[model samples]
Target: MKFFATCPKGLEPVLFDELQALNVEQPKQTLAGVYFGGGLEAAYRVCLWSRVANRVLLEFHRGPGETAEQLYQSVQEVRWLDHMRPAGTLTIDFTGQSEGINHSRFGAQKVKDAIVDQIRDETGRRPSVERLRPDLRINVHLQRGEASIAIDLSGDSLHRRGYRLKAGMAPMKENLAAALLYRCGWPDKAAREEAILDPMCGSGTLLIEAVLMAADIAPGLMRKEYGFTFWTQHQKAIWQDLIDEAEQRREAGLQQVKSRFEGFDSDAKVLNTARDNARRAGVESLIHFERRELSRLSRPTGEEAGLVITNPPYGERLGDEPTLFFLYQHLGERLKADFAGWQGAVFTGNPELCKMMKLASDKTYKLYNGAIPSQLQIFNIRQRAVPEVVEVIDVQDDSAEPAEPTVVELSNGAQMLVNRLNKNLKQLGKWAKRQDISCYRLYDSDLPEYAVAIDIYGDWAHVQEYQAPKSIDTVKAFTRLQEVVAVLPQVLGFPAEQIVLKQRRRQQGISQYEKQDQTANFMEVREGGCRILVNLQDYLDTGLFLDHRPVCLQIQQQAKGKDFLNLFSYTSTVSLHAAQGGARSTTSVDMSATYLNWARKNFALNGFAETRNHFIQEDCIKWLKAQKGENFDLIFMDPPTFSNSKRMHDVLDVQRDHVELIDLAMGLLRPGGKLIFSNNYRRFKLDPQLNERYEVKDISRQSIDLDFKRNQRIHQCFELCRTE
Candidate 1:
């Protein structure tokens, strides 16, 4: 007989080793499973002993299936009576697609029809389809117009170890947990009687699997049913002998095993569930479960070093990435402080987050937890290095004032940058104070060598380094950047960490909206009369555009008693100002859901009712084109220079599409209402024909604020009203 054991992707090699250990012959590895020639004894052994196999299959037939009809005929040709009776319940699992069979359900339906029709013709009683616990689970694979059929020997996936009656959030599958242990060499550690620990062990899957491996317990012993139990070829005597042998081994291993395990989680409710799962796995006494935070993680009492393995949250299931970064950092700190001289392994889907751990891993193994590509990083917890301190000399002065600290040496270029920054601050600081502006640009590429835009939000500065040209020396540019960062703390009075640094490259399409980091580090700053939140670290542009300050204020001044529409309303700061100006209704539209969500939070922050204010998340052009009636008294439009986002039906170029966009906005405006059109494209030219259709006035000068006066062409603005 031939058999196949299926496992998760990237576990083929490990599954092959497992089949070889089970004494199966010619175990050949495939993409996500292993195939081998084995008898009933070998097949039953794999079903009962293999920890990582999701399902074991008994190969039945290989035939041609060029079409759905051919597939039905191929399935009907199989000797159905040899495996299952007519009255038995069965289910068909069809995978892969052919030119003729594009849908899996359609293919599965054909296979079912073939079997039921054959069974009914032969015995006048067809088997009923049962989704759960069927007597025979038929598996079919169609590839390149060929079909391979098999009977599932393991009724449910082997990962369903039956011990986990309930699971906490983002629980790791039992087989994936087993694979992690095998990759981390937990089996060898168990032989040495070394303990195991998991700091963020939700529901104790890892701990339970560790204890089972150490105790030489068969993972399938807890399962109550097998797919072969009701099969025609199943021999009760052969299976009973294997079961008896496994039972004896289980008893002996339980008595002789000496390794211990511990699992900790912050949620007490999840700890209760972990304890219950451990009880069900029959390893409750050998493992300890506790509710503890990652910060308080320490070694088990009176135990030597062991293994620390955990599957922390990977931002998809539980918490956000920024918080999870601290979680990983604390995990590393605790491991270094308490678990030195031990081995550690972290399994996570977000591999980039492991950089926060601050420990060097010696090995990394790629694995998959379902569809999520994951990695298991193994590291030895060595002693941490001590930090060197710089000694300072305190010199007594006759004036009795505290001696000045060491002055940081700056290069000539850095001093030039310092002079320019001070000059701008001295001139703009008083103007900003008078205008009550908390967020404004201090310097925009003031010096040619140090090409960067330094903007201050309240006290924290946001510095964006423009990508240097190839002619500049890379090392020189880097040194200048270091000087710029070094001088900000002294010149701006904000700490270095508070100054968020980002590299600005020319962005295309909606890449500007793509997250630079998952750190949602938002700070609230006062802009005009309203409070606006800006995330300096997470994107190329902050939530609020400093150049648009005047545009937003202009909308606010003219927005009273008007229904306002804001197109391409990135974060809707202008709409917020309009709402503050007592607009009867405010509508904001943008394609990026992230920005729309930010706008919603801004509205909530300002205590604006969602009922009066509307935030529509759609492409502005598409939404505007879909509208038919006049709806707004005032409209403000600021569009990107160019966008070819996948979500948009067509690419948008502001210069080519501005006339159409303006016309669309005007179509929705009341006869007497006006439209304020704006774009950051420096060389934008208004369509000559638009001037003949409406009264177009250039407000570009009025829209340019004092801080932006140095860069007069930062943006262009216009006011368009119908000429009756």
Candidate 2:
């Protein structure tokens, strides 16, 4: 039989790869989907093993349709009666793009009407529409003007994998989450001294999925029923044999895959859910679940190297910005301090929050959670290199009060120490200009006796002075000093990556962590439509953070005729960009009346109508709470990092309170609407994870940019859709 394995967009390659690894034949890719030829056993196995596929559908028929009536007629032409009994319950799902037939529900209704009419006219009985559990589930795709119908052989969405009897806020789908870990090069062997960890394991999806994969356990093993079982062609013996074979494989591989798999969530409720999910998967004894935040993660005993994988809360989930940044920064510090020898992997839709991890990642892969394009960045944590002392010198001042040193002038109108051999500023400037470089002269003797002057392409200057020189010979050596300063611009381009050196002695016994340097000039880039201008420098954060890049692109692509709302509007980036992309109107909300004012400035910068843009300085949750029936076509939300708002009725934390926010926000979305929610909290998890009520896609990859080169995940971006 021909089968179509539905996977999240961008994961088709991964599903194809898995099929190839399994030696399945004739695998072909489709848009956001894939197709292959296989038998019932192959179907069962694919459902069990394909990590990236959401569901396995057995293709039944196809035809052309120009209108809803034509679609109904085409669907009725299919031999549905021969496939299932008249008394069996069935469900119909409609998807894809088709002119004059955009409503999936209406499409599904038409198809269902056709199927039932044909069945009842022939047999005087029709299968009932079973939404939750179905005997025969059919998927109808109407792309362009063509319609294809398929039988859902797996019954429930394959993500129901039976391992999760319980779930916490925003638990990940089993298959996609599993594929993410596998893509990270998760070792197949279970006894290889590898440790699998999820620092923010909401219901332990990653941890449970990892364990199942390591043990080679079939995902379908725990499922009690399948759609194919009700088909007239069902083969009882063959299905049993396949199940037995899968069990045998699991038993054979059990001892070979005894690695430590662990999950940690700060919420006790989530921890309980994780425990229940593991128990339901029948791997509770093998996997350890704990209640701990990222900051509290400790090195597991006897583990030299292991995998630390996590999906942290984003700003939308944990509604405080500063707290989220600090949380991420601390997570980075903890990873560096505690798990120096481990391999770390963080999965997030937010690139800005990922930067908080600070550790440089070695590899990054793009994965999709529904429609959201996310990044899985892998970091190889190693001990920091000890700083080498180049030189040491003793300074002695003989004067009772150090007499002011006399100034000396050199050729080319440059000043320097009288006896120093350092090159003149004018010659250095000439050499830099000749080389077409943005940086050249650094640190010349001028003004105060201890002062040193530096020039940056004549555009900027940095001057520093020291009370005494501990390494005068090292400072005076032009050849070695030039090489050191040149290496900075070579590795990181001049002007783009330039640093001035300053040395100062701190009080004894004081330890200083890396201080964020914030002295660079900020450059703004007008996002394609000129609605949003993002500053690239000044701080580690660039003007426009990348993880939200995809969502913005989606807005530009889909925002026609849509009224946009931007919550917690920092600099009104999304609103401005959306408006510039042709959104009808925009409303930006933030508590910091200051940020709302800045948002207005951003709108004016984009030449958008001050009348078309609405700025609200009220608290978001309260505002949302107050607006009972407000609806929008497009809503972009990135709540605070953490907050006491929900309790105080003033602030909100996206991670702790996203379910309420999402629930509230969904009410504010009009029929056939779209909402893009994001957060920068490193461990933000979705609350009351939505299954079918709305389509949720992680769009984090498109958010990354050169500014977040050190760490890929800076934010988590999610696209939510409500279809009429």
For TM-score, the strongest prediction is 1
Give candidate 2 misplaced runs (Cα > 4 Å): 97-100, 189-191, 385-724
lDDT of each: 0.86, 0.66
Q: Show pairs that collide, candidate 1.
A: none
lDDT tens readout by residue for model 1, 1-724: 8888999999998899888988998999999899999788998999999999999998879888889988998998897988898899999999999989999999999999999999999999999999987998999999999999999989899999999999988889999899889988888999999999998788999999998899989999988899999999889898998898888888888898888788987566788899999999898999888765454678888776799999988778765564465457657767787888889999999998888787999999988877888999999988853211111111224476532323589888888888888889898999999998878899988788888999988767899999999999999999888888888887777756568899998879879889999876777676777757788888999998899898888889889879999999999999999988778789999999889878866665454535467889898999998999999999999999999998899999999999999999999999899999999898999999999999999999999999999898899999999998
TM-score of 2: 0.55
The CA-based lDDT of model 2 is what?
Answer: 0.66
Runs off by more than 4 Å, candidate 1: 385-724
- Model 1 residue 237 CA deviation in Å: 1.1
Error of 1 at 367 (Å): 1.5
C-alpha root-mean-square deviation, candidate 2: 20.4
lDDT per residue for candidate 2 within 610-694, as digits (tens), equals 4456888777888888996655888988876765432245445567788778878988988878778888777766654564577
Q: How many collisions per candidate?
A: 0, 55
